[model samples]
Target chain A: MKHITDFTIVRREQLGQHYFALTLRHPGTLPSIAAGQFVEVEVMGTREVMLRRPISIHDVNPAENTLTLLIQVVGKGTRQLATLQEGDTLNLIYPLGHGFSVEGRNPLLVGGGAGIAPLLYLAKCYKAKGVETTILLGGRTKELIPVREAFEPYGKLLISTEDGSLGEKGMVTQHSLFSAAYDHICTCGPTPMMKAVGRYAVEKGVDCEVSLENMMACGIGACLCCVTDTDEGHKCVCKEGPVFDALKLKKWMGIE
Target chain B: MAKLETKIHNITLKNPVMTASGTFGYGEEFADFIDLTRLGGIIVKGTTGERRQGNAYPRMAETPSGMLNAVGLQNVGVENFCKQVYPRIKVIDTNILVNVSGSSIEEYCSVAEQINELPNIPGIELNISCPNVKKGGMGFGTNPEMAAQVVSEVRKVYGKTLIVKLTPNVTSIVDIAKAVEQAGADSVSLINTMLGMAIDVERQRPYLSTITGGLSGPCVKPVAVRMVWQVAHAVQIPVVGLGGISCANDALEFLMAGAKAIEVGTANFVDPTVTVKIVEGLQDYCQRHKIDDINDIIGII
Candidate 1:
């Protein structure tokens, strides 16, 4: 039982029609979070939703001890979470799951939909380490993409939209910059999109890692509910990884 | 403060908070967030003779104040559990109660027989409530005669305490409770997840991959208490209650309704340390009420 000391909604900014970025202050523990970790937020306004929604760590400023989450109002929980104002307290469990492992020198970051949250944190960490980083963000349309300016300071930015509304005006794979120009590729998004990126990286003989979005019960490994088959039989997405080397992912989970 | 302790049948629990089977894995998964030694017991996921991969995607969906899960009893076979998970979990301080599920009476008996040989294990909770499998989980439990047959066969080989977990997805829970009691069950746990389903109206498809699932959470607490009350009155054996117990107040409701002990299920997902809190809460409730012995409140309407 992790106790929540305080919850401060720092600010809320609408990213698109349905998505909003919530900047929160969780003084003591929020400062220590690494890239790719997430927090389970309990929605305060609604009586309809029961389970807490698991949101990715969009950005974190350890100096200020503040955390920001990029949330899409897909359902009742997120809608209620969106209603929270500054100084409003929430029940939050943070720094959950195995975060990313940045071992390589130059890394290629890929993100699609809500998966972009963790990629931004990854980009920041890599750039701070003096590693050359590139980020490719994908969404349904230009307006659906989030946090373009914040990521600019960290690395090269590439955008892809399904409706040809921004950047490459096509799928992320069609972008000219994604022609295996980087040393390693890291991706998070819809299973199909990530699998496509992973398959391309494998064929080009570049190392790749993918963050999975399996629906979880405990966010810990206890439920055996969020397991993905890998070369190692079965591994918990919350424990072994929410991030896995693309090469190790089994065929059924889609990476070749 | 002195720690609270409880006993169900011959098994001595350090506290009255145990993780309901199917919710908490073999106890090692929550080791980082909770102190397993502080808990009364941990019921492992349901296991059978052969490995089951369980249902497809979208096997879970959240409802108002609760959730539905149709995991279809996905488990590594009995051999793998004994070889892989058991060795590691045997080291934990809490009592480990293996939840046995099967497709046949023979399968149930075999699983119980193997577990009976394990040194540290205290008991077996027969999961007769799983609704997702094709054969024998909820199948035996829905029918009183079949439920008795399965319990009787498992009892023959099982020398330790046998707790038959009853399903509430039937007409009369009391009838099923009576059936298991007559079969020589040491105790019975009431109200496993209720049969339920959710729909994605936009897509016009069912929410769960199985089309239906077992519902559990705070929403089901009253119904579970009602069943526990009815079942306790129908049988002389101890009745352990579950289904939607998230706090000590909720657990105490079951105890007052005639349950000797309670299992915390879906609440584990809400808060991993819920069982420890529940035990402390129970002690606090007893202390405030000027009750010296915690068991004094059991079945005290």
Candidate 2:
């Protein structure tokens, strides 16, 4: 079941120039949140911003009853969220959309820019299951890949930056790990990068899932504004999935 | 408790708060956040004769106090609705109505006729005012005669309460409202989203794939209120007002302007529980004002 709750900001950390990881604790017991699910955060008391910002679930601590949101300031809603301080009240509708299926024996997790947010939680799930995981994170520069150290304990972490400011200077797809044999692949990032990963997965005959950050209105399925065309038809990214099998997405596999 | 009941033609609402079409989906989307039985009505997404894939992606854009959308009336057509949607939604306790849209007069009547057969559905909101579709939506609504013609045709096959939704993009909204009322509509709902567009200056391109879409939200409230007041006096039928209604104060503005009931539209996106909150607010308003029945305030202005 989904919930609309007023949570208090327990911690706020500025990881980079524009990235902030906010830890919010619900007053009540937190619902079970999956690895790839997200939340619609209400930007309280903002005059200009009308819609809530959808951010991926970066990490969750059930014992603390807290959820961590990894937000990048790209627009007014997110920029407003950056001003939030610890102890401030924030409202959220959470545990939304279908998350990634934790079923891979040896999984290759790929992330680009802000797309790296959800993978940390996914890697933790894979770690708990004793699944061998390899994560490749990419960004335009080193500053873009902010939370590299957080994923170190959960998996083998690899990094690539276009400016050669970090490990293995190149796009994530160019990383040496791409050539490795993996039973399953999951990625979230820029569309072009995910599509390239999807194409590679198809060629390798490996099951893959990509989380799409489509523009949305209501984080619920009511608005039908955030639909992505698929082999089945148009599916609401907020409802049916923000994470989908690479094969079902027409655009991802280069299908008509 | 203040009497919150209101009537539109033969259909009596438990309250005067109905979820607007398109914004409410099939009513199940909001069930997790709100009690489905507390609403006055649930107007499902636009239903047509056949499945419409709708327009291409990039169908929505956010503006200052509002948003623009060209969802193009995407739905599972009437056949699929009866088979797949109806059984699931029939369990929802409140009044369930379908916003019927089409690209042709025959298509409109066909969908309406099918919905009329459903035992649980008490009414159909004939959508001649939708500005998103290219063919039959706003085309029928902008012109008074076309609006009347479509309503009159749908009224023949649909026996239940018929509410014709109106468009505000026209020169005179009252003209279209009066025409629909004259053509056998039991009630008239105004106004659908206004025709509008936006450009992403950074990208130097149109924000929406359709280039133009329906504008809705708090910014459109004044225009909607003005239109509702104008049409409420011009026609004898009850007026169901909607367009940027987010709170009870906003709902009261419409009721005082002569709307018998109000539909909460874009506000649902900002707050999923807004409809029920508005319902509670209405009751609170009635108690605070010492008003016995909510109907006593209709058309007071």
What's chain A's TM-score in each predicted model?
A: 0.93, 0.97
Most TM-score-accurate candidate: 2
Model 2 error, position A210 (Å): 0.5
Name the top lDDT candidate.
2
**Which residues of candidate 1, in runs, are more than 4 Å off?**
A1-6, A29-31, A228-235, A253-256, B1-4
Question: Clashing residue pairs, candidate 2?
Answer: none
Error of 2 at A41 (Å): 0.5
**Each model's TM-score, in the order given?**
0.94, 0.99
**lDDT by residue for model 1 (B13-110), tens:** 87777889878888876776678898888899999998887776667788888888887888888889888889999999889999999999999999
Q: Clashing residue pairs in candidate 1, if any? A: B217-B244
Scored against the true structure, residue A101 in model 2 reaches a CA lDDT of 99
Instruction: Put down candidate 2 lDDT per residue, A1-256, tens digits, no spaces.
Output: 8888999999999988979999999998998999999999888677788988889999999999998999998999998999999999999988899999988898999999999999999999999899868999999999998899889998899999999999998888888778648889999999889988988887778999989999999988989899998888889999999999988985645855
Q: Candidate 2: global Cα-lDDT? A: 0.92
